[model samples]
Target: METSKVIHAIYTDDDVLMAAVKKVKANKYHIGEIYTPFPVHGLDKAMGLAPTRLAITAFLYGCVGLIVATVMMNYIMIEDWPQDIGGKPSFSYIENMPAFVPIMFELTVFFSAHLMVITFYLRSRMWPFKDAENPDPRTTDDHFLMEIPVSGNEKELHDLLVETGAVEVNLVNNTH
Candidate 1:
């Protein structure tokens, strides 16, 4: 566990942060976490993180929404109480599919958007009314913080971080 002697390297420029991340990985240090004010391009790749699968999950969610919309429309329009919608006799779903196209598209996008957000939140362990786990409030505004666990080479890590243009480097000792 990364429970003690973690170094919090703070950087002001994203480019410097990116360079520091690459150099740190090259040196084979395990990075615990990183917080940034905004999303940095290619930062995940620099940190050697695995690619996310959220896009695939969103596609599956969209398919479910389309299926739900199709079944709901068929039941409501054609089976339970058939109505002559738009002056056309509604006997089959395929016959009146043109009118339902808008509803189907809207539902598809709606489910994909809403469910994707929920999935991201759950995947990131962010739940309703959860207390913030941010280590530094300045990271939310204009600073970037890289957390590296100090495993018996504190002096070396401190020197490397200072060489990598860190504005401030603080060693945080956890009580647990």
Candidate 2:
């Protein structure tokens, strides 16, 4: 079985890459992937990708963290070790609840940060101990790369890529 081959075109400027992407999208050519050093405004719309739902996930995780912190602190300080030692009273739920606010806030932030990071990594198919899958290393620095799988005519695709402002184009075959 033969899988689709990927051809990457590297561009020096983001504007040029964006124009190329827009042209390809307008031409109804399928764009396999795009890579840039930083976020490109309007790239998602050009690529027809749906809006990210990461913020919603973070909010849900924060709620979970808050509940966990509240329950754990309430049970431990009020139910399990109910005793008044400092004369200020420790068994009162209101008194100890205020003290738990700091822990609750910390856990909320911790869960949101860690879980959001993990979510992003997994969504992007990235993880620890995994080799980076980059077509061109320069795309991580000062270049923008577009990987398009050629389907019909190679010459037309190459011509379209060149005319749209690609600095260099190269084909990489993965045959086993």
Candidate 3:
């Protein structure tokens, strides 16, 4: 496969990085990725990224958890073996729903949290024992790295990044 050229621009401060992102977008340059030590609020919006649909997926997962809890409880307490507790016989699901509320709530939270984490990992190509893909180690601590594909106009792009307050700039040949 052919290798592609890219530019890595390092910024010391997130404020500068955020401004640079906006300038890059205004200039119509395509940004490959950005690595930051911590979450930078509004960076996604400045990068023009699409809104995440993770909330919708979490809701669906919560619903699945609720259904599973309901079925399991009904099977165990009513269908398999009915028992009297607190003077109420476990012969119906509706009458016993109040008691199962805590179980359903717990399961819903558990499924939503676990499934959301798994989904994020899968979508980001991150898994246990996976090698890190960060181009610069400093980006994981104090610096922010912004990657931009080079489409022959390397000088212009480099100059733009420098003007945008990049602390350092390096040209890289990226091989996927």
Candidate 4:
């Protein structure tokens, strides 16, 4: 089966591009993606993207890290080798928490970073050693791009894009 053709419009000014995106979204057209050299504030909302839950995922992962660290440290220091060092009580977790702090912090950071990366990769459909899908090469270098899949009628979409002050309008093809 053939994929739908993607029509892309490149804009130089981010403000005008954002306005155009808002108009497109208001008109109920499906936006394939938007690429900008730098992040345009509120662009996700303009694109009607659902709010991300990455922060929540990170928090849960961090909690897991804390639990693992606490359990491991308690088992090793308190249970396995119960030696009172530095005039501190080995049996009291509350008293020995200061010693466990560094490891706890390290584990928290490790889990949060790893989990966030994995979540991003899964959400973006990217995998290790997989090439990234780039729609336009120049978009990575100082270009603001908006891409939309073409429906049966393209004249209005083209006119709207042109009127919205697109510097260049072009079609991207998957077929080589």
Candidate 5:
């Protein structure tokens, strides 16, 4: 199996990392990955990443929750134990909807928040008990790491990275 080389460019400050990301994109070098201690503002834009679809999924999940809440409430209140309470008819789901509105809203928010998180974990391939994929440990603390594939152009990439104020640059064998 052939092994490819990747350059790990370490940056101390987020501002310098942002500049490096933009410069690398302008030079048409594809960035493999980046690790930061915290979320960097506009890093996705700098890397030209597409907007996430999490919001769409969250909306869909919320709809599902609403449906589930409606059906469950209908079954429990109207079909199973229909009664008149407080001079109001409980036999009809529509007439009793006001009481269920709070429940439906709560379920919607609950489902959206929880399912969105689960979807993110699944999409990111972040399984339970999985080992961390970060190359440098410092990236989880104070440093930021940008990984760029070395496609027979290590010298030029290294120079550009250094010029971009990379604190350390390393060429490491990466096997897929």
Candidate 6:
């Protein structure tokens, strides 16, 4: 694949980064990516990203967990091995549902937590032994990096980024 040139704008503070993002968007420049040491509030809106649907997936996973717990408990305690407890031999699941509430709640929470993590990892293309995609290591510590694609106007973009409180600006040829 052919390599593409991108401009990397480094910022020291997240507030300056946020304002720069807004200014860049207002000027009709397509931002490629932004790397930050921590999550910045309202940054997604500024970047024009769509809302996440992870909560809906989590709810569906929790529902699946609840159904699995209910069915497993009913099969084990009622169908396969019905035991006499508290002088009652009622082999019905409804009558014993109160005793299974804790299990159901725990399984729901467990499934939601685990499945959400897996989903997030897969969606973000993260896996064990994967190479890091960050261009600057400082972005993981104290600096924020913003990437903008170069479309034959490198000097103009560079000057604009420098005017927007960027500490340093570098042109990078990214090859994947």
TM-scores of the models, in the given order?
0.95, 0.89, 0.97, 0.90, 0.96, 0.97
Q: Model 2 lDDT vs. the true structure? A: 0.85
lDDT of 2 by residue, 1-176 (tens): 57777778889998898899999888888898898999999998989998999999999989988888888888888888877757767756677777678999999998888989999999988988988777678988999989888766677878899999998988777332
Model 6 lDDT per residue over 6-48, tens place: 9999999999999999999999999999999999999999999
Candidate 6's C-alpha runs over 4 A off are none
Whole-model alpha-carbon lDDT for candidate 6: 0.95
Instruction: State, as a TM-score between 0 and 1, how close model 1 is to the true structure.
Output: 0.95
Q: How many residue pairs collide in each prediction?
A: 0, 0, 0, 0, 0, 0
Evaluate residue 101 in candidate 6 and report its C-alpha lDDT on the 0 to 100 scale.
100
What is the lDDT for 113 in model 6?
96
**Residue 130 in model 4: shift from native, Å?**
1.7
lDDT of 5 by residue, 27-120 (tens): 9999999999999999999999999988999999999999999999999999998878888878689988999999999999999999999999
In model 2, the clashing pairs are: none
Query: Which of the two, 1 or 6, has more TM-score?
Result: 6
lDDT of each: 0.94, 0.85, 0.95, 0.86, 0.95, 0.95
Model 1 alpha-carbon drift over 4 Å, by segment: none
Any residue pairs clashing in model 6, and if so which? none
lDDT of 4 by residue, 1-176 (tens): 47667788999888999999988888788998898878889999988889988899999999999999999998988888888687776986777998789999999999989988998989988988988566777778888889888876578888888988999988766441
- Model 5 clash pairs are none
